[model samples]
Target chain A: MILSILAMAFREIRRHKMRSALTTLGIVIGVGSVVALVTVGEASSAKVRADMAAMGNNLLQVFPGSARRGPVRTLARPFQEEDALAIRREVGSLALVAPLATHSGVAVAGNSNHFTNVWGTTEDYVEARGFRIGRGRVFRDSEQGVAVCVLGNTVRDKLFGDRDPIGESVRIGSLSCQVIGTLQAKGANAWGSDQDDFILMPLRTVQRRLKGSRDVNSILVSVSRESAIPRVKSQIESLMRERRKIRPGQEADFFVHDMKEVAEAMQEVTGTMTALLGTIAAVSLLVGGIGIMNIMLVSVTERTREIGIRMAIGATAGEVLLQFLMEAVVLSLLGGLGGVLFGLAASLGMSAALGLPPVFVPWIIGVAFVFAAAVGVFFGFFPARKAAMLHPIEALRHE
Target chain B: MTPLISLRKVCRVYGAGETAVWALRDVDLEIDEGDFVAIMGPSGSGKSTCMNILGCLDTPTSGTYRFRGIDVGSLDRTQRALLRRHAIGFVFQGFQLLGRTTALENVELPLIYQRVPKRERRRRAMEMLDAVGLAGREHHTPAELSGGQQQRVAIARALVTRPSLLLADEPTGNLDSARKFEILDLLLRMNRERGVTVVMVTHEPEMGEQAARRIVFRDGRVESDERLRPLEARTA
Candidate 1:
């Protein structure tokens, strides 16, 4: 019985092809936009996570001042190399520590000049900051305060085209330094900053030969294990407070930042954005359901005589209800299927055009299809009931 | 044998209070098996109301109606529908065949409601279409068929379920004189050959003359009842 009713519904829908297609348009657009937006958002979040991971895993940075609270008011003097050495010796959860000082300058080699950032750090900077030596070796410990430098991939490409830069000499400011190594290629960071555009030299060399100062700007720390991050962070905070002479109930002169916090914040923002877009698209689906209800009511009124004929031919009210309800469900299901195809195509187009990774989420597709069928049932009820409750005699008498 | 239908003081009232209109008032009726009865009256004389009650499509406001020893007035809506589904068939004046459906599908509607298997349903529907002289026109929709052919399809649908009682309200009202007699002859043949009890409401005296029994209604009451010679015998 249900099969016959479904067949009748299919025939009826096929009879008025244009109206049925028009009614399903809203649902198609709704599901399509929902899928596209969620897929793009997920891909973007994954990109952020990858970028963060590339920066450094389980890494933290300690800055000298609480700059976020107000203007850069210096309550404590800048860090020295001794602070990094003390943290490495005292903290049990510490893996590696590097004190860093940075300055921007122009480097000249063989009549070629390029403006690049230069960093002063120890040998531990390579491991703590997740850098690799692509060509030559890192400077020896005994080579501190000597005129030795390492070039980043971008700096190497800019200053020395395709030639080998190892054992060569470059002029930094008024000082000449010998290049000892070249770092591997590390792409852009999460904030779109180029990470491989800087040069690294020994801390004592930058202090004595370049800056003529012993102040370090920041200190980088890597934890031994991911589960020990919180304990290590608290230890660094208290150690810094004691070393900077910060008493109880007083705000410390420094702050610690974990890379995981930034990743989590970015993930949260993307999740909220996806949900907002999904809600707006869901509203369109509701509007589509309303369109179905309107057309179904009109159909019931137009087919009153047919309803009378069926009733007289021994169709129960429940049977008539099921027939009309099935029609609405079939209509919405078709729309949903079309929407899924459109959504996948749109997502693929976006990924290709925007250079984003494609993300296919199975649950989103399942949810959208199920919701479309539910919309049919919820909105189609009133019209089907109206068709069922019609009086056979009065309906037959209707002109 | 038990009567096929019995009614006692059946009254059908519409509206309320000062605007109350009695469509049927204090009416009593009985019909036996294998009887072809014609209900004849002018417009607004309650003939259609009587037909509706007999077909189990409507219930009286004040009285008892029994069909095959079952109390129709006391039955719920679903039970009444079940009774109608199994034992009653109806044909209408407008040849109320579904517009877009084929002749075979229209005939198969009752069997579909009965949950008959697909193959059996097709065979039974095809047989009924062939019996109605529409063998080659089974696949033709109502729009593609002539008026007489559409009426024939409606009659085929009515008799497809092998119903014990057939109620037709002006089955030939929309047809020309030639098509009218053709449909009337078809109904007469069903009654005489198959022993099916038929109660038909018609406005024409000639159509009334074709029945084995004639009943006339006036002002919501029966005015005359007569048993006439079978039209088949008279014509012979």
Candidate 2:
């Protein structure tokens, strides 16, 4: 019984080459888009995880409040510089502490002015975050209170071109600081902003000389151990409350920014995007299923007399149904296999051609194949049953 | 003599309520094994319905239909289907072969339903096609074959199961004289060579003369039935 059905399916495909190719095309497109989208999404998530680890392997962020409902430490109400120093002194789990300050304006070097943000950190900044110097030397500890600077690769390229920028001067607002080093390029972030286009200066240089005195935007704290992070954050929060003399039930004005927490948030956002794309892909699969049902119905109609002849020749209705159903499933399965092959090739092509990494997942591939087959079964049954239940005598008599 | 097919007071009423129409009424007949039988009548004379019942494609609404002492009237749809597949081989007036399938594939179809093994199925199907004088034409599809050859493929399909009863409906109704004779001769050879019981319906008296027995039907009932004398016996 199984053998006959399989033979019939093979014959049907051979006989209707164009129609079968067209029908299988629907499945190929459906599964192809789904698999490609999923693989790309997985690759992206993995890349984000690697970047987040590189940025801060042992960092923990503490927010003043939960996400969404609260304003993230208003610009006018800045976190105090003393809060960072206190977190460092009170928390024994700390490695190096730095109060982060950002000031965005036009930076002028060699008569070429480019709009960029200047991040202010002290000498300990190099070890606090994993900042590697691509060329020249990092600023000395003596330069913390002086006007010295390190340019990210893009800033160095845009301002100094191929010429050496080390020991040269660049102006941020009214202050002129000497460039000491060029940091390695870190590419872009999830927000589509370049991470390597910034200029870094000594904490006091920006606080006192450029932006004018003592106000810090956020605290960048590096924990010595992953396990001690939560405790260290809580200790900083409590010490801040004590130092600021804030009473019970009053909110603190300061917030901590950690790369891991930001990465988690970014993952959630992208995960939702993947789900949205997945839903669109699923709709296409449903469309493919409907395409199978539609084609099977047409086949049933075209083969009505043939069905009758088989019954007249002694085939049971079940046997007839089995034949058509098997044909449908075989069509989908072939299409699914073709789709997987095409999808993998497309992913690799996209990676090579566009320089976007594509990932491969076995479980997803298996699931897509099964899903396509299931679609065939679900949609093929009705039309096949219709063909089977046809009255043999009447069918035989069909013109 | 064992009766190959017996229908006692068989009636087939179609539709329901006021629309109910009787196709066959009070039909009683018995065909012996190895007999070539023809039920002849005009269109709407219930001859086709009788053929359907005899072929196990339809059941009599009322009365008894028994094949070799088995009450087909009591059998359900599946059992009747099994009987069709295993006990009877059917040929059609239209030469109802699947359009895309080759003659070999068409012949192997019924055997496939019979759950025959692949190698054996193809071997037997080709043998049957060869017996029908369609030896090299096994790979030709229905569209590629002539009317007579298509009918021959249908015949091969029917005989592949090695069924005892051969049921044919208007076997030559659509063919030219030459094609018609070719089909008739094949059926004759099958009946005489294999002792296969043959049941057919024909519009032409010349077609009826080929059979061993003649049953004339009109108004959904048997008008006359007679055991036919063979031409050789008459000449002798």
Candidate 3:
């Protein structure tokens, strides 16, 4: 009996080839969209994780914009040089604390002139960021205005080739600096910006010779343990607040940048992207569902006499309903199974093309397949009922 | 033989407008077990309505209906369906097999409604398909079968449940002369060999001559019921 019903379902779907194809197109679209969106989101999250781990996983940032700003995005107050030194001196949970002075300038290295971002800091900056000098030693504290420079990996490759750029010289603004070190290559972060295209200098050299600014753009504070990050971040926030002399409820200019915090924002944005992508893709599935409904409706109309014949042969209303409902689910499920395969292949191809990691997100797979069955239930119910409620005598008389 | 079906003042009214017509009015008909009967009528006669009530597909407006000594008029929809599944088999004029379904599957439908198990249902359906002389054509869908083969398939479907009562609502209405003879031969064989009670509604006078008894209906009442002599028995 079960085989008979299944056979009937198969026959019905087969009879309407064009309609079946059109309906399957819906499932394909819905499942394809969901797969691609989720895979892309997974790839992005993976990228964020790699960045956080590379940028000293246990690091925390203290800024003036946070402690007094609640959860809002605003510049709180400037974190002075005194606060960073004080945190480094006072905090026992810290591994290292580095103050950053950043500015952008045009630099000329052997006729290769480009506008590049420059970061000046102490030796602790390299340790706190888990970066190695890749070629030469970092600058000495007393080498202020000594015109020594360290080239970023991209800058080094673009400026000097195989001739060893370690001894090369570059002009930054009015000051010409000799190459002291070359940075190791690091890839781009979750953001599309290049991570290895910046130039690093000593704090005093940048303060005195480059931008001539005493204010720091940001501070990097590294903790010795991951479990101690929150405690360390809160401690640094209060310390900065005390030193910056900011009143309660008043905004500060500085902010603490934490990996988890950045990840949360990244997750929200990725989530939105996933939904938008899935929603757009899911329209196809909904269309596929409607197609199933439409086909079932047509089948009901065509099989009026058949329904009447069955009723006369002792079929109850529930039995008739069950038969058609089973048929609809079977049809949609077959299409859904085919769609899963199609989506898998499409996502693999897309992932390779986009150069992102390929992930088969289980939640999406479950949602697509089960949701297709649900769609069968959702759309199939009405038509199935109509077929079941038919008066057997009337149906038999249909000409 | 006990009355296998009894209708007390059965009335089936069609349409609700000013042109409302009574298909069956105050019908009280009875058929004994293993009877071969034909309801003969013109196009507008009430024979079809009697067939519908007998098949349990229609309920009387103000009458009592009994099948196998059970009061069917009081039964709920579910109970009535159960009664139809086990007690009645229907053959239709147009041979209304579900399109694109194999002959075997179409024959298996009534058994499915009976909740027959998979293996048993298939076995019975195949057996009936073969019994109707469509032995090798079980896999062929209705569209792929000829008109005669399709009618045979409908007959097999009607008889699969081994129901005591078989109702054929103009069973050969759409068949060619040859196909109509083949169906009539199959129906007569079932009546004579298996002793299955058969009630047929047909407008053909020649077809009416084949049954053991002919009931002629006109308007909303029975015009005459004549005991027709079986061709072979009476001639022999």
Candidate 4:
């Protein structure tokens, strides 16, 4: 019996094909947008996480002073090399600490001159910053005062072309240095800055030859174990404060940043964006449901005589209600299925166009499908009730 | 044996007080099993109202109506619908066959409401269609069939459930003279062969004279009741 009623409902919809398609259009668009937006957002968020992981593993940085200006003490000078040494010596959980100084200069190799960033750090820089050499070797600990440099992938490609750059000579702002190694390729970072667009040299080389300064701008530290990060961070902070002669109650001039914290903040931002877009899409679905309700009410009014005839033929009011309700549900489900296909296509197209990986989450599709059916039930109730409540005699007499 | 239908002082009032219209008033009637009763009246004389009450589509505002010894007025809407589905059938003047459905499916409708299985429903509906001389036209929709064929399909539908009481309101009113006689002959044959209690409402005296019994109404009350050897009986 139920199957027959359902078949009747489908027949009714087929009888008015154009109107049924138009009525379901709203749901299709609503579900399509929701799935596309959520899936693309998920892909972008995953990209953010992958980029964060690429930044460094269990890394932390301590800057000269608090970048935040409100109520925190400002340092009068940049961080000296002694701060990096002190953190390495005093913090037992720390595995490696390297003072970093960066400057931008034109690097001329043979006839090629490319502008790139130059970094000055110790022999421990490669291990602490998660960098691997593709060819040749890093500078020896004893070669700090010598003029030698390691080239990044981008700088090597720009200055050396296809030739071997290990023995080539490059001029860094009037100072000549021999290339000792070439770092492996690392793609763009989270901020979209090219990771392989810089050169690394021993601290004395960049400090003496490039910047002519003795102060290091930042210190990069890597912990030996993941669980030791919090302890090492606090120890480094206290050691820096004591080294800088800050009072017990005074706000420290330096700030320590954990890569995990940055990654979490980025995740939160993307999560909120996905939720906001999802809410807007859900509103569209609600509007689509309202459209369904309007059409269903009109359908009930138009088919009054049909309802009367069915009732006169011994159909109960409940049967009429179920028939109309099932029609609405079937319409929404069809729309939802179409929308899922559309959304997947759209997401794939956008992903290809935007250079982001496509992310398909099963739960989101399941939820959207169920929500569409619920919309049918909720919005279809009023019209179904109106159809069931019609009086057989009055309805039969209706013109 | 108990009568097939009994109505005692049944009254259906439309409104209250000074604006009230009494569609049926203090009407007492009885219909025995296997009886072919024709209800004849002019417009506003309440023949249709009487049919509605007898078909259980409407309840009398006062007094009692009993069908097969069960109080119909006391039954709820669902119960009345079930009673109609299982024990009563109706034919309307409009033919009332669903316009877009095939004649076979239209005959199968009452069986569907009865929740009969698909195979049995098709078999029974086919048998009824064959009985109505529409065997080759089972797949034709109402619009594809002529007026007489449409009324035959309606009759097939009405009898598909093997209803004990068949109530037809102006079954031949829309037919030409020949088609009217054809339908009248069909109804008389069903009444005689199946012993189905057939109650039909018509305005033509000739149609009324064809029934085994006739009741005439005027001003919402029965004016004359007569029993005669119907035309079909004398011919048979």
Quote the lDDT for B94 in model 1.
Answer: 86
At residue B36, candidate 3 shows an lDDT of 86
lDDT of 4 by residue, B96-153 (tens): 8787899999999999999999999999999999988899999999999999999999
TM-score of each: 0.95, 0.88, 0.87, 0.95
Can you give the lDDT of residue B213 in candidate 1? 94
Report the lDDT tens digits of candidate 2 across residue range A97-160: 8777879888899878888988887766666767788888777767776888899888988998
Q: Rank the candidates by DockQ, best first.
A: 1, 2, 4, 3
lDDT string for model 1 (A321-378, tens) is 9999999988888888888888889988987786677889888789778978998898
Runs of candidate 2 exceeding 4 Å displacement: A58-81, A101-119, A140-143, A146-148, A165-180, A204-215, A224-231, A341-355, B229-236
lDDT of 3 by residue, B1-236 (tens): 44898888888887877988888888888887777899998888888778877877778877888898898788888888898888788888888888767898889888877778889999999989889999999999999998889989988998999988989989999988887888898999988776788999988888999998899998888888887865232111
| Fnat of model 2, as a fraction | 0.91
Candidate 3 segments whose C-alpha is farther than 4 A from its true place:
A62-81, A103-114, A139-149, A167-180, A208-217, A225-231, A245-253, A349-355, B15-19, B115-123, B134-149, B174-182, B228-236
Q: What TM-score, to 2 decimal places, does chain A of model 2 have? A: 0.86
Which 10-residue window of candidate 1 chain B scores lowest in summed lDDT? B227-236
* Per-residue lDDT of candidate 3, residues A90-155 (tens digit): 777889888888878888887788788888878788778877778998887687556687888888
What lDDT would candidate 4 get against the real structure? 0.88
Put the candidates in lDDT order, highest first: 1, 4, 2, 3
How many Å off is the CA of A145 in candidate 3?
A: 7.8
Candidate 4 collision pairs = none
> What are the lDDT figures for the candidates, one per model?
0.88, 0.83, 0.81, 0.88
The docking category that best describes candidate 2 is medium
Candidate achieving higher lDDT, 3 or 4: 4
